[model samples]
Target: MARAKNVLWIMCDQLRYDYLGCTGHPSLKTPNIDAMAKRGVLFTNAYVQSPICGPSRMSFYTGRYMRSHGSHWNGWPLRVGEPTLGDHLKKIGVRNVLVGKTHMAPDLEGMKMLGIPPESIIGVHVAECGFEPYERDDGLHPTGRPRPKYDEYLRQQGFEATNPWEHWANSGAADDGSLQNGWLLVHADKAARVPDEHSETPYMTRRAMDFISEAETDGTPWCLHLSYIKPHWPYIAPEPYASMYSTADMIPVIRSERERQNPHPVFGAYMDMRYSRNMARDDAREKVIPTYMGLISQIDDQMGVLMKFLEARGLLETTMIVFTSDHGDYLGDHWMGEKDLFHEQSAKIPLIIIDPSREADATRGTRSDALVEAIDLAPTFVDYFGGKVPAHILEGRSLLPLLRGPTPPDWRKVAFSEYDYAMQDVRLKLNQPIERCRLFMVFDGRWKYIHASGFRPMLYDLETDPQEFVDRGDDPDCAGIIARLQAELFDWALHPNDHITTPREKIAAYADNQLQVKGGILIGIWDEAELAAIRDKIDQRAKM
Candidate 1:
């Protein structure tokens, strides 16, 4: 099978797996995304290593688990020297470029200690999550940062405000011409004051197109990470998109009364949080969900625009396209608001890959139920470009085999995810120390088990309770199942993820007494014959 010349990895922030039309959303009309899915392979059981944005994105970028990468939360920097998709692709002459959000915080302390300037080529790639940033915007500049290029663009477009992102792009206009903050759920149904073309989603899409054009002009094989920060928060859409959906289009909230009464200690603390409690209210759902759907609709339209541009430029046939999300928003599912949980709503993401190779044609419009993770994309990109995946560094196996043909018999049986709630108010509510605020989740297609560091483990039989409404953590009958799942987690944790410097082959050779055996300093040799026997066993080839 031949490989595509380039990769177009389009990502959406906080988009749920089931929210797209192709993925069983009854109300949300995502025709463009659905078309992409039909032209590719869509994964049904893809999950992120972490349910929050930064850690999850770090996992995706580095092809390592969150624990392996050591970036456990938002604003935490991925340490230097970690090989990312770009680093791997660069070995095979592919450039990885970014036109949108990565949520990658630079390791300033590490850089400073190493005496590396941020503007240095290596330093810039390290700062930008191993991508050449055509335009980097995290899309949540609420206050107190240097003015962004988007704000300058809004100014050039005659939109005036101290913070145009919050004003024209994120806020709504009241009847009296007053600005209504999109942060409030009451204002969620209101349209953003800015035009649709000037909004964040469209602006980022245009940037992505511009990048592709420039990349083609430069005659370089490139991977463009066109990440959109909509369908996220400040749940306000522009113009026609804002008015596209109504409360009737919103799906029924997945929460139940049982979840509210005497919930698990950690779960109850999350439910008690302001956002979760607000999302639990019917009024908040009425105002916010429709707007969230609208934001997604806008994203879908942008996808259509991007695809059409790619086709028009004769780039579609040569570019492998991947559409996915970093993580998912809870939207009040399991009595939670934002992501940071083990629920499918928060961790399971929509993954669609359209490999332009002829070998992928047979798998087009097919669905795979393989247990996939966000970290897998890095190795997939590396493999697609004919570069060997560094197994010691990358914990994820490439998904190319799954995409092109049948799943490997040794495919993973369980998917793993984690949450570091130490930064959350839930930690304070539980009165847990920093180290004990960790939560690890393991799911083997049917049963989902959560190991909370300081509390009882949470378990759910998804075979019987697909919605995950009932928590069987305290049930004595499920003790054996919990133990088995815990063992899976333990075995996964025991993997030496940080042992990346030495190749496994080299380690094995050393273990087999193959390290410097030909040297004269043979410790076990007693006589000339003993040394002769050891030297004979060694492959003495071309010593000079």
Candidate 2:
């Protein structure tokens, strides 16, 4: 089997694991994604390193924990010196490119401290999360963070506004000529005013195609991060997609009154928030969910288009296609409106990897229940390009073994995720300090444990209560299980993933090298005989 010449890493923002037909969606038909799953390995237990967009993506880019990277929230910059997937792949001749959203804020302070300019090649990579930004749009253009590229594109296409992204692309028009803002749940039923071809998804897909053409012309082996912003917020779709589904197509909302009653203090604070309370209403779900499903269907159609384009260019067979998400949207699940907690609907993401090599054929169409982390993709790409996985830097194991014949002997036993809510209103509602607003989750297939800083831990037995309708955190009967999971969580947290300066293997080689004695800094040398024996031993060891 030949190694893949390129990789097309596709990611949909806020897409859930179980929302696709491949992952058992009850009504939604996603044939394009489902076909990709059939041709690849569908990771059933894939979890993100963080539930939030920025930190989760940073983990995926660097193959390190959010805590290790120190970018704990949105708009927080990834440190300039941190190594990314692009940095690792470029060393082995893979040109890393980006077409859509990364949610990556640049470390301007760090870059300035080192006298690095934002326009230099290294500075550009650092600013864009190590990817060469063919077209980088973080996709959240409310008022302040306007994406100039997409906005200008929209205006060129005749959609004019102060911010066309927010005006036409994300808004719907009523018969009376008033704009229905997609930001409000009441207007989610209206189709977006933007045309299908002019929407963000199609535009980004075209950019990806354009990049592929240029890369092929230049004969550069590329890893394109073709990320889509839809199936995300402003849950309104354009044209046929908007009218595709109704309330009948919607699945029953996965929340319970029991969950709302006296929930964990941290969880309760989140539920009490405006978005959560709004989504908890029946009218809100009825109006917003179908539109959300439509947005997903629209993304699925765009996937079909992108796949066809790849195949027509004779690149499908040579490109290893990966489909996943930064994190999952709650969508009124567990009485939540956004992805900020450790429920399966929030942290568990859909991961499908199509290794185009013949060695992966045996595992094709198989679903792997092995615990997979979002950080694994970086090392997987490095391994696919025949580079050594630098354990001192990359904190994740490669998924190539899982895709090919031999499963790794030391596979991960638990999946981990994190959340930092200092900027959220939930923290203020709880009267918590900024430093104490951290949450960590550890899931070992059946038992899911969440450790909250300065609060009681939350526990759930997925084996017994798969829906997570019951919280066993305060139950005395679950003491032993909680204790074991806590120990495992602490064990994971104690590992020094941030120790990047010295390689462990290098340290191991330095053991008993007698450098102190060789440098004349011996602490306990008593006599000439002892010193002579030590010198002789050092010589023998060096020769061996």
Candidate 3:
């Protein structure tokens, strides 16, 4: 089998694994992705470093954890010097093209619509990620009605939720409305269709497809990325898919109190917060599941149409199509409705690779339970494109060997995922609970160790308690377990967050973007220098 010169990386925002039929949801009809999974390989236990959008994507491109990449929240772009798959691909003769949103906003405040700031780092992130011919969607709502005016929606509801931006997204406006959703989902029928002026996904998808078609004959293998924003937020799918799945057929609540043992305080506290909102504990899962599954079903429909175009021109076999998501959505899990926090529902993502050039043994529908992280995706793409792994010493290993079958004895037996949701994510959003944002999780294949930055730790035996409803990180009886996992967690904690640095330290590089760490600092465009001076002042305080 020869190498695959063409690659298609298809990404959806906030898509959970269980919500897809290819990943084992019988009720969800994802024939294209499922069929792609059948012919390719499926990683059943894939997780993202962060449970949010920008950070998850940053890890994918940089092969570093959120804290390491300094992208702990929604809006931060990679420091200019950060390495990216696109950067690596270009070295091996693959021209990189980007389509759709890469939520690498410059600061957390940029996520006002999603508990973020007023500004974002989209341009900087795209530049740092190293992909050329960049196109992005407007970070506002998708409706010609001007995204239903989130601020206005909040005002209408008499919501005094502080941040007007955050309050709107959290309003019923976020959900895909149907009778089952009650008031939880905003009924916005006029929200459908991506307008030619502001529609990024549809326009970018067509542009990406055109690139794929043109690249096929150029004799230069290319990596074309088509990122869709649907199935993410404001969960309004078009007709048909919008009404595809009914709540009756949706999978009901899956909490097993009988399976509960010890749970983390922070995790418990997080759920309670959601319940404090409008999220209910009773059958809330059933109501949300259909809408979530329907969103996925809609994404699948678009993908199916794309595949048809590729196959129509006889480009399917020669190209390797990789299907995945930036992160998973909670979809009302644990009385929660969004990403963040350290539960499986929020951290898990789907990774499927279909390499048409692989031998039959590697091409079948076999599933591997191996733990893979979103960061590893870069190396896998680089390896497939016949490119060199830049000398960055990335945190994630390539999946090429795993795809070859039988893991090597010396290979790291466990997969690792980390989240710093409490610290940076909190500070980014002003007035966030300063003390509560201290949770950290380290998951091996079997056991998971969670160490809250400033609180008691937690441990869970994922084998016996797969749901992770129980915590043993501080259990006196499990001292040995805590001691062992802590060693790794501690090393990871103190490790330098940067992976790909620049030749000119002053000119930090991102994928297609760049940052300046010249003064040994990188700050937001506004107040960056002022913040630096403030940090210097704070550093003197530490000395005092």
Candidate 4:
């Protein structure tokens, strides 16, 4: 089959895997995303490597786990010399560009240490998480940092305000002429002060479409990362979307009394986090959930706009479209709000790949239960361009085989996710040491094991309790299962590729030399004739 010439990877921030209509959400209507799923292969068990933005996106871009990338938290730099999807794709003549947020922290310290100027082309690419920025919008600019470029654009468009990003885009005007930041629970029901078109979502969509239009004229193949920063925090939408859903439409909370009683220490810490604590209240859910749903609906509508534009431009037939999220918000699931936990609500993300190739015809509109991860996206993009995956560097396997009809026999059986809350204030307040503030999770289809440093592990049997209401980690009967899952986690922690930088041929040659030097399994004493032959061979090799 012919290769796809372009890749349109659309990523939404903090979008839940089951929020779409196709993913079995009864009330949330995501028709456009559902339609995309209908025309593609929707992975039912896709997970992120890390449940936070920067580290997760690093894994997605680098095709390596967060441990491999060494960027464990937001604002942490992806260490220098780490290869990314852009670094790999560019070798094969594909241009990868970012239209919106990557949450990539620039490696200024690394650059300084290496004496590489940050302004250099190579340095800029490394700092931007490997994509050439068509428009870099990380979205949140509350204070301390420079204002978002999108907000500046709004200011230029006659929407003048001291901080347009907050005052207009994310705030709702109070009746008494005060501005309420959308983050406040009271403003959850209020519409954004800005118009729908002027919001970050549509602005990003416009930039992506513009990039596609420009890329169509360019001769080289391209991958455009249209990363949208919506359905995220500061949950607010404009106009009709703000009033789109009522509190009655909100899905019932997924918490149970069993979860609240004797919760894991780390889990309890997350539960008491500001967002989680607030969201646990009934009043907060009543105010925030509808707005969150509205934001998602807004994203779906924007998808419709982009899809139509791509079709009109005649690019839809040749481009591969991938829709996914970095991580998912708990939305008060299991009594949590934001991600940073290994619960399905936070770790699992929606992944739909629409390969516009005839080979994918059989799998179109089908859902695959095969395990997938955020890191797989990079290798998939490389495979779509007909380039060989760099197996030595990338830990993820490509999804092309799954996207086609039959699944490979050796596909991954277990999914893994991780979170490092050491940098979070909650950990500090709890007096937990940095080294002991991390968690790792291993999950097969039916069972999950959560391993946290300096704390007892947590386990859940998904078949019996899909809501993850039970913690079986301490149960005596499940000891064997916990041990087995712990072994799995141990095996995964042993990164085989670590520190192996030599070429395979060189390593093989070294092995051969060792065997020869050691003279393994000598059958008999060398005769004078054999000694002469060996001496002659050695002399010949030395001369060469």
Candidate 5:
């Protein structure tokens, strides 16, 4: 089978693993994504290295754990000189470009310390999460620094407001001539004021389609990271999508009294936060959840539009379509509103890879329960292009083998995730230092363990308590299991690609050659014929 000539990586923000029909969402319609899964391999238990947007995406883009990249939270910079998917793909002659948000912060300090001028090409690439930005839009314009590109586009369309992102794109109009900002609970059911075509999701999809159309003119293998910022916050959709889902269609919240009562101190802190506590109310959830589902449905419809465009252009056959999200949204699940916990609702995400190569035919329409990580994407893309996996630099194993229908015998058994909430006000109230405000989670399909810095560890026997209502960390009988999971976590924490002074090839080049020195034992002989050949050369040299 031939290698995939191009890659189309589509990432959605804050989408949960079970939200799609393919992943067993009861009512949410995601036919396009579900069909993509049927045409490829879907990983049922994929997890992110971190449950936050920026850090999780950094892991996926760099093929390294969050610790390796050091971009621990939103607005944090991925330190300069770190290798990303774009960097790895470029080595094999693939042009990786971005069409949308990366949620990246440039390492200004690292650039200054390294003497890299911000105006330089390398510096520009570093600032854009290592991608050559075709059309970059992080889509959080109103909250963060202003993005003039999107704002200008909206103005040209005659939205004509001080902050179009807030007034038009994210908010809706009430009958009484009042404005609904979408963030407030009172406006949760309101439709977005912007037209469907001008909304962030469809606009990005159109731009992605344009990128594909342009890339086709040049026959070079290109990977376009088409990221969409939707179904995230300001969860209002345009027109029909806004009215598609009612509160009746919203899935029941996955929480229990046992979970809210006597929770672990760290978990309890999250539960007490306004984000969690506000959503705990049934009224707040009913008002917001329908809009959330509406945004997801809108995304799914746009996906259909994009896929049809790809098929029409004949690019679908040659392009590998990879779909995933940065992390899951709690939406009142486990008594939490946003991600940053070890529960499946927050850490687990949907991963579908549709390799157009005939080699993947056998695995098509099948699902694998193998523990997959978001970081595996970079190595998978590299391997898809027939490039060698740089194991020393990229800490993830390639999924090409699994995509071709056979799970490698050495696939990972444990999945890992992490969170650091020290910067939050809740941490200050908890009196935990920034250094001690972290948590690490390890799950082996059945049993899950969470280790919080400066707090008691928590355990959930998933086989018995899948909803995670029980904390068995202090159970005397579970001591052995706790120790085993702790050891696994310790082993994972030990190996990070921090030191990059030497490549793995240079270190391995000396491994066996060191023993072949002048006074070393003769070890190259395979059989008598080879030994005799060597002896003949030695004898001739002795005579000389």
Candidate 6:
């Protein structure tokens, strides 16, 4: 039989495209990813469907949008029977294994919906990546650390790596689980010194390679989705990568007060100065840029370990290696820190695929202007396995054509990127900045239209102002462009190809669970008459 084609999907958490050398970051020392770029097709303009972690990951895992999966926010479960990349691989003759932080449905209730019994989780080959198992004593963010007593539990397992005592000896809890509290992510002075065994990258790379070796011997083609949560926060990476960038050299220009301050009321909320006061205080900005670069460099180094394993095992010639991220970080762009919305900084991600057989010398090292979306990835892999495409389940196209041809077949076509139904801020009620209810955008090489829920649409000519400082919606010259884009947006809105694919009752129940856990009703109240009309509309949709 022909060698079983294996798929090694390597994903980093919250990584931006420009943070790597391959993506033209002058200061980035991502030698591993850069080397892989030489052999694979690097997509220049790949975007995530949702800007936040959970929703973005949902689209990637399901190959469907948040509207389709019913997992719009964190804690919302991916409904039963919704196919995943793992599920698709299993559908074929492949054995699928998820070996790392599958933020999607890693807990109990979610596994129930997916028909994976608790008993089945035991004895599985799983993730061994990251600085350490974020000792989740608090049970907030998955990366949250365990109390010292928990380290005792590891010692019980004969743990000899970390001192464990000194790791969090004097670390104070600024904010248990809040990205908004940027200071909560302390300057990890110790992170740069963390050793190899404690590092998640080396651990994950070893498991992935071992898994590859075991599969090869077993005569089974495997698909392993390995997620590494690094360069996300806790900016700790071992030495070399830690020293890669200097604060003086790494600080990209921050937005000046004179720049058109609030671009889109929604977009502005993300990059707002008041929002990131903590991160910008007293040289914090300078320290942050180099640290972020350092974290990325470390991820690249660990990525090197996996690449070396592939070459040593002679699997490089047959396996498909994919590198991408759940979302991007603001990283001081527009005076922002984390990924909370649909900005160029957070929405754009590094998407590279190395299909061992296809040769693209003319395309290699060169970038493709082809507009690709996160939703396209699952279907692309599905098609790679010679599986039939389910038209109803997929809203995006595979990048195979773009890899074959550097420029998009149609230059006029644009890509779409969106944010959440309710952009949350604990400081403000979820509906407070109802500036834009829905964020939708269509942008080619030049212009972008930010469609809001209730406010005026935002138009920007990226060619004239790449920084997106000036809003062109009011400009008379761009009136023609605005009208054309509005028409396109209206058409798209009327018939969203993938809108809450699950039943209304199911979707409503999930949203209800969200309200309950959050202890706040974020949905706007339209009077009974309006709600009744909406229900009737939904009933009408059901009939259709």
By TM-score, who's the top model here? 1
* Worst 10-residue lDDT window, candidate 4: 513-522
lDDT by residue (20-87, candidate 6, tens digit) is 88888886688989988887888877888777777787788777766566666654555545556666
> Candidate 5: lDDT over CA atoms?
0.86
TM-score of 2: 0.96
Better of 3 and 4 by TM-score: 4
Candidate 3 segments whose C-alpha is farther than 4 A from its true place: 1-4, 106-128, 138-204, 256-263, 274-276, 281-287, 422-438, 494-544
Assess every candidate by TM-score.
0.96, 0.96, 0.74, 0.93, 0.93, 0.77
Each prediction's number of clashing residue pairs: 0, 0, 37, 0, 0, 7
Tell me which residue pairs clash in candidate 6: 99-127, 129-200, 130-200, 135-145, 135-146, 436-453, 437-453
Q: Where does the lowest 10-residue lDDT sum fall in candidate 2?
A: 512-521
C-alpha lDDT of all candidate models, in order: 0.88, 0.89, 0.63, 0.87, 0.86, 0.64
The residue-by-residue lDDT of candidate 4 on 1-544, one tens digit each, is 4434999999999999988888988888899999999999999999999999989999999999887888999888888888899989999999999988888888888889998888899888888888998898886657644336787899988888887888888999878878888878768889999999888899989989888778766667999999888888888889879999998888789999788898888888889899899888888888888998999999999989999998887787889999999999988888888898888899999999999989999999999999898889999999999897878778899999999978899998888888888898878766888888788989988899999888789999999999899999899999999999999999999855565366566666665442254455534436878766766766776688
The digit string of per-residue lDDT tens for model 2 on 167-216 reads 99899989998988889988888999999999999999998998888777
lDDT of 1 by residue, 156-262 (tens): 99999878889999999999999999989889989999999999899999988888877766777888998888888989989898899987888887877887778
lDDT of 3 by residue, 1-544 (tens): 3434677889988888787877777688988788888877898888888777777888887777766777766655565445667667766777777776666543323333344223234444345366654455424342321222333444555644444333333233334552222224434222333222223344456767767667656667777777777577655444455466776666655454532334454555555554323343445544455656666776676677788898897777778788998877766655566777666777888888877665535536878777788878777778776666653546777777777676556765555565655544233443436545655667777788777765678777989988766666666898988888889777777864453453333343233233345688574646768766766765776577
For model 6, the local distance difference test gives 0.64
Error of 5 at 76 (Å): 1.3
Model 3, global lDDT? 0.63
Better of 4 and 6 by lDDT: 4
Give the poorly placed runs of model 1, Cα more than 4 Å off: 1-4, 144-147, 513-515, 528-532, 539-544
**At residue 118, what lDDT does model 4 achieve?**
82
